[model samples]
Target: MLLSVNNITIAFKSKKVVENLSFSVDRGQSLGIVGESGSGKSATALAIMGLLPPTGRVTEGTIELDGTDLLTLLRNQENYRGRKIGMIFQEPMSSLNPLFTCGYQIKETVLQHQAVTARQAEAQLTSLLEEVQLTRQLGERYPHQLSGGQLQRMMIAIALAGNPDLLIADEPTTALDVTVQAAILELLNKLRRSRNMALIFISHDLSVVRQVSDHLVVMYRGRCVESSSVAEVFSHPRHPYTRGLLACRPRPHLRLLYLPTVKDYMEERPDGTIVEKMPDNPLLGATRGSYSPSQFDPLLKVENLTVSYQNQINVLHSVSFEVFPGETLGIVGESGSGKTTIARTIVGLLPLKSGKIYFQNYLLGKARPRSVTRQIQMIFQDPQGSLNPRMTIGEALMEPLHIHRLYSSRSERRQAVIDLLTKVGLEPDILSFYPYAFSGGQKQRISIARALIVRPSLVIADEAVSALDVSVQAQVLNLLKSLQQQFNLTYLFISHDLAVVKFMSDRILVMYRGKIEEQGIADQIYQQPQSEYTKQLIQSIPQYV
Candidate 1:
């Protein structure tokens, strides 16, 4: 085996984060380590890469690379880290250095391990960029100059600089769009086969892992619940955790009302261990009652909407759409495809270069009135960023109510906040706590509550559930549907995830380069996409099969 981890247990201070995990990968083979956050998949990768935090230490077992212990090599960082084991981290933007050019980083890495001359390293940098399907010109640009996919490709080039025996990709394609993700996976597989390198692919995404790995190791709460070949695991998963994960993925063809949660298949053992038993995967259908059948009454309208940065960089090009009451109008596109621009323009956050915006059949002036702001609420992509860190949950939610002067009485506002908190599946006690105290999913629920507290008719959810895990995403989606039913709220749901858009949207609009490629009912659009872009987007969805 090129890489062998034998019954490894990792700990930080008194707490054991990972326990008795074992896996092996031969040259040109890939092993997939998959689980939710805190399940020790990334911990195991860190243990192998010797990049764990200062407090984290491997307490048991041995990690061997071709019979040599990695623990011993950790003592000499220069000896094995860059030379033997290359790693691609989760976030490309953070993983790459912004100060230096992509070429400089790759060249430096090559020089560090191979002892190559400056000219030779430069040549090697060019070769690496080309190997990763990047142009030499792009290497000269800084990290910010490149797109997400480009930055990720640059990261892969850097990882391949020393031509390490094994590459550890930790959630490499998590942030990427479907097409970009497929390209990266293909590139990794190609490089792995060509270089004859072993791989440790760690991700929460099972379908992505299935595409790259031969062996699958399913983890739950720091334990490897099941380990087997990818084919076997997918076809005949014995563990309930694995089955739940398989069923949780939102399929392109199957429009599920709600995804199966991990709790459904799990029971607490007497000793505190989670006993996982396979459950029947039920296909539940959602009613379209929340969506208004009659689309004649439009709640919001955008006509010839054009957005640009400094009157130079054109973003949205004559973008026009109407959001009807009690219906979700989903805008589907990749990054920089002007999806959020429409949302921002509608919310009056961005000044349109030339456009007309009508809310409730009334034309919005140069700047939308405070009344419009109160009626049209927007939920951003990053829940944490949208919320104030210094402010408590109560303070945050109360700001909207306070701005509108709906409830002049503080006591009444507090009561409303408590009720809104309960509606979003959060308790009143949490109102005292800060945003940091909440998980990503919980923070999103808080954001939703903040949006709804004003009693807005139109809600622009801009990639709201993109960052959340599958089960949490399901919960949030269910909550959105239920709230929509109760409030009769009009929704402008924006996302790059086609499956999610299909599930939530009454009507789907495919956007590419600021232009609408196609627009139709969700079922018809997913089933019979007329545009090539839409067809490609649907096909790119990662399938468990």
Candidate 2:
């Protein structure tokens, strides 16, 4: 084995994060460690690299690399990082330095690992970028200048600078669109095969992990519940946790009324044994719902909508669409494809170059009225970023009610807040807690509650569930659907995930490079995509087979 982790236990301070975890990878083989947040997959990766935080320690077992003890190297202050093992982190934007150019950063890594001159390192950096399928011109630009895929490629180029034997990818493609993700996965496999490198792929998405890894390890809370070949695991998942992970993700081929979560598949005893439960039939034939634009008056209309940044570059060009009163009009595209720009423009966050927006037949100008603001609320991609960290949930939810001046008394507003909390599957007791006290899923629920508190007729959800785990994403998507039905809410949903967009949208709009590529019924768009971009997006979706 190239790398072996035998009965390892990882802990931070007095608390155990990972217990009795065992896995191995041979040369030129890929091992996938799959789990959601707080499942200790990343902890195992960190332990192998000796990069754990100050409070964390390898409490038990052994980690061996090429028959050499990894802990011994750490204790002796010997460098195995970059020389023998390299890692690609989850978020490329945060992992890379923003101050320097991509070439400079990559060259610095090359110099640190290998004995090379400055000019030699620069030459090597260019070769690495080429190997990762990135252009040399992009290397001269800063991190922000690149797209999500480009940044990830740059990260891979840096990781490959050392020419390590083992590569650890920790959620490398989590933030990327389907097309970009497919490209990255292909590139990684190509590199691994050509270089004969052992790979440890870690991700929450089993479909993505299956594409890159030969073996699979399913984790829950801190234990390795199941380990087997990728094909075996997918064909016959033994653990309820594994089954839940497999079933939770939205599938392009299947339209489910409600995506099943981990909780729906199993109940965990206090002693930690799992009891499997029978899941309901969630399949919906053909489509979720049907809607034609001519059926009802348009709730929102955008005519010749054009938006530019600093009057030099046009981000949205002559975009036009109409949203019915009770249907979801999903906009699907990659980053910088003008998805969020449309949402932001309607919410009065950006200055349009030339356009006319009508909400309820009333023209919306640059500065919207208080009434318009109350009725057209937005849920952003990152819930934590949108919410105030210092403010309590009650204070955050009630701020909108206070601004709109709904309900006469403070007691009425409090009750309204409580009701909204309950509507979003949260408790009234959480009103006293701050945003930091909640998990990513809980924060997103709070964001949803805050958006719906004002009784918005039209809600713009921009990548709202993109960052959530598959199970949490299922819950959030179901909640959105239920809330929409109950409140008669109209959604202008925007996301890069096509399966999710297909599930939630009545009609779909495919966008590419600031232009509408295709727009039609949700089923038609998926089953019969006309444009090459749309077809590419659909084909890029990871297949179960």
Candidate 3:
């Protein structure tokens, strides 16, 4: 085996995150770790890379690279990191230093382990960029100047600078669009084949992992629930969790029933004990409560909206849509297709170059007061970036309320924060915790709570659930559905995940290059797409049996 993890256990403080998880990857082979959010996939990779935070430690286990125990190595071990192992993280924006040029960053990694002058390092950096399928000129660009896919490729170049035998990529393609994701996966596959390097690809999408991984390990609650060859596992999944995950992915020509998650059937007893019951499938439930088109009026209406950046090209062009109360309008497109720009324009973060926005028949485009901003709330794509890391969850939640002056009394404000947490399926005690302390899923839940604190008439979720796992995504989607029903709230749900959009959206709008290529009922669009872009998007979605 090129890399082997035997009986490994990792812990954060006193809580175990990965317990006795054993896996091995042969030379030139790919192994995948699949699981839901907080399932220890990334934690396991961190432990293997000797990059765990101070609070997290490898409690027990042997991480061996070709029979050399990596866990026993000291930080100063000369050949451990650069020569034997390399890692690529999930978010390129966070992983790359904003202050450095791409070439400098790559050169730094190469020079850290080798004796090389600046001139030689520059030459090596150019070759590294070429190896990662990027043009040499791009090396001079700052991280922010590069697109998401280009940034990810730069990260790969940095990871490979040392020519490590093993590469650990943790959700490397999660933030990319479908076409970009396929390209990255293809790049990784080609690199692995050519270099004979072992790869540990960690992600929640089974279909994606299956395409690149030869072997698969299904993880849940820090345990290896199932392990098999990708073909065998996908064909006949043994564990319930694995089956549920596979079933959750949107499949072409297959109508997916909403699969039950571990949380749905399990509830706390009156005495604070947990018990499991037969799971209730929400999608299979009676259609008796189906939404009617006439129940509520349009909460938000946009007509011929157009927006452009400062002294730049137009990003959104003549877009028009209405979000009715208690309805979800899904905007689907690739990255930089103006999906987010549209959301930002509607929420008043960006000025309309040309257009009209109406909320409750009031012209929002002309409104200048802060009161108009209170009725429209937006949840960003990256929860961590959107949230203030310095503030605790309670403080973050309370800031919106304070700004809007929703509550005057301290007691009432405290109660409101607690209620918001409960509404989002988080414990009230978590209110005192900071954003950095929470997992990706928890941070997103906090983001949702913050958006709902002011009780806005319309909420724009901009790729809100894309960072989450399948199970957590389902729960959050169901929560949004229930919340909309209870509060009569309208949602402008934006995402790249068609399955998620299909599950939550009443109407779907497909956009390409800042234009709405197609718009219709969600079911109709998915079942019979007319536009070529929509057809390609539907076809590109990963399929599962």
Candidate 4:
């Protein structure tokens, strides 16, 4: 084995995070560690690299790379990290230093490990960028200037600067779009083959892991519940958790119900013990109900809308669509394809350069005296940025109600805030907490509650669930569906995830370069896409059997 993790255990402030987990990776082999968030995947990676945070410690374990024990290394052991193992972190934006250019960062990494001058390191940095399939010019840009995929490639370049024997990638492609994700995976595969390097691929997405890993380890609550070859494990999984994971993946051959949650498989045994079973939640199971067309009139309509920035570069060009009273219209396209511009224009946050917007048949233009902000709301992609950090959850939730004068008394508004919290599956006690106290999923749920508290007929969710884990995303999607049924709400769902778009949308609209390439019913569009862009989108989604 090129790398071996023998009976490892990790803890955080006296609480055990991972327990007695063992796995191995051979030269040129990929071992995937699959689990949900907080399942100890990142912690395990940190322990192996000897880079755990101050609060965390590897209580018991031995990490061996090529016959040497990494855990036994001294605190200031020279050349330990760079010469043996390397890591690619989960968030590229945060992992990279904002002040440094890509080339400078990679050069620093090379110089840190090797006795090389600045000129020698620069030449190596250019070669590293080419190895990762990035353009040489990208090396001159800062981290902020690069896209998510480019940043990730730069991260790989830095990690491979020392040419370690093993590469540990923790959710490396999480923030990238699907097409970019596929490209990155392909690049990683090629690099592994060329260098004969062992890989530890960690991610929550099983479908993504299956594409690159030869060996698979399924983790639950910090325990390794299943470990086997990727083909054997995915083809015929013995563990219930593994089966549940496989069943949750959105497949092209099957119609999706609600995604399978971990809670779905747990059962009480006759001996008063709980046991988990496989195939408890089937992907092809019948859903609660098919979406019915709304009886009410259209809530929001855009007729030949055109929007441009101050530079006169057209962002949205003659886009036309209508969101009915209780329907979901999913707009899908790559980055910078005018998705956010449409959402911003509809909420009156952006100035429309041309075309008309109608809310309940009332025109929306700069000439209008009244603000339609209350009836049409927007939930942004990043909840942390959208929400005020200093304000309590209650204060943020009450802003819309206060602006519209929805309540006569403060007591009534307080009760409404509690009700909204409960409606979105949060406790009333969370009202006093700040946005930073909550997880990504919780923040999004809070954002949803805030958007709906005003009783808006329309809600624009722009990549709302992109950052969430699969199980949490499933719950949030379910909440949105149920809320729509109860409130008769209309949604303008804007996302690049085609599976999600197919799952939630009544109608689908494919956009490319600020133009609508195709528009049709969800089923027909997904099954038999007429446009080339739509067809490419359907083909790009990762497949699961």
Indicate which candidate wins on TM-score.
2
lDDT of 4 at 408: 95
C-alpha positional error of residue 120 in candidate 4 after TM-score superposition, expressed in Å: 3.9
The digit string of per-residue lDDT tens for model 1 on 1-545 reads: 78889999999998999999888999989999999877898889888888899999999999998998888775586677878899999898898888999889999899999978999999999899999999999999999999999999999999999889999999998888888999999999999999999988988878889999999999988999999999999999888878778877777676566666666677778886777755554534443333335537688888989999899988989888887888888999999899998898888778889989899899986766788888999999999999999999999999888889989799999999999889889999998999999899999999999999999999999999988777677778878987998899989999999988988888899999988898888888999999999999998898888
Off by over 4 Å in 1: 269-271, 276-295
lDDT of 4 at 542: 77
Q: Name the candidate that leads on lDDT.
A: 2
Listed in order, each prediction's TM-score against the native is 0.96, 0.97, 0.86, 0.93
What is candidate 4's lDDT per residue for 217-255, written digit by digit as tens? 998778898999988987888877677677665554444
lDDT minimum window of 10 residues, candidate 1: 283-292
Q: List where candidate 3 sits over 4 angstroms from the true fold.
A: 11-15, 53-59, 72-76, 107-127, 250-259, 264-298, 366-373, 384-421, 427-438
lDDT agreement with native, every candidate: 0.87, 0.91, 0.84, 0.85
Ranking by lDDT: 2, 1, 4, 3
Error of model 4, residue 342, in angstroms: 1.1
Winner on lDDT between 3 and 4 is 4
Misplaced by over 4 Å in model 2 are 75-78, 280-294
**Given candidate 3, what's the lDDT at residue 196?**
95
Q: Pick the winner on lDDT between candidates 2 and 3.
A: 2
- Cα error of candidate 1 at position 6, Å: 1.2
Query: Which of candidates 2 and 3 is the stronger one according to TM-score?
Result: 2
Name the candidate, 1 or 2, with the larger lDDT value.
2
**Local accuracy of candidate 3 as per-residue lDDT tens digits, 67-174:** 988878766545778668888999899989999898889999999866789889888998889889999889989999999999999999999988889899999998
**What is the lDDT, from 0 to 100, of the residue 147 in candidate 4?**
86
How far residue 200's Cα lies from its native spot in candidate 2, in Å, is: 0.6
